[model samples]
Target: MPGLAGTERKNIAPGLAVSIVLKQDQRTGKLTEGVVKDILTKSPHHPHGIKVRLETGEVGRVKEIHDEE
Candidate 1:
């Protein structure tokens, strides 16, 4: 929890635990927690956050990467 989660592409990877904001939830700033199944963002950085697919088959933009717990 000490380290920061960057929107840069290098900061996210498959199998990492992360919190993402789904398209519908963006207005409310909702966060969904799940293990990353894939990185959907093609760019090196995104202002809104990197898009990704979770293990649960949900796709969204990563808001924060969860530290090992």
Candidate 2:
């Protein structure tokens, strides 16, 4: 799913890798890849994307979830 509404918390664990769209890159629809450090979205679903903080300290909405291996 491109948006976070279809994603579940279990599917996006803290150590999982993911591609997200940062605030600065939202206009270009750029994707930043990083390991999830924290899940900021408390709601069950969001229309835009699930807000999360990466290990690198970058915060954005998850666009795609990637496997660790």
Candidate 3:
């Protein structure tokens, strides 16, 4: 999917690289890239995006899921 959704957890597994918008950067729409550490959103779908914590310990909503290859 282009935009991250809560239901797309399978598409965004741990260790996967992704771009996200941090709580502070929501206004600027800044994208932070990092490896997924944990999935915080339990819902199947979120309007904004699936919230997750990166390996770097940065928490944010997934904006895009990057391919491994």
lDDT per model vs. reference = 0.89, 0.82, 0.84
Question: What would you estimate as the lDDT of candidate 3?
Answer: 0.84
* TM, every model: 0.91, 0.84, 0.86
Deviation from native of the Cα of residue 15 in model 1, angstroms: 0.5
Candidate 2 residues 21-48, lDDT tens each? 9999999999999998999989877767
How many clashes show up in model 3? 1
Write model 1 residue lDDT over 1-69, tens digit each, in one string: 346564889989899989999999999999999999989999999989999999999999988888886
* Model 1: how far residue 38 lies from native, Å: 0.7
Clashing pairs in 1: none
Looking at model 2, report the run of 10 residues with the lowest lDDT sum. 1-10
lDDT of 3 by residue, 20-49 (tens): 999999999999999999999887677788
Model 1 weakest lDDT span, ten residues long = 1-10
Q: Supply the TM-score for candidate 2.
A: 0.84
Backbone clashes, each candidate: 0, 0, 1
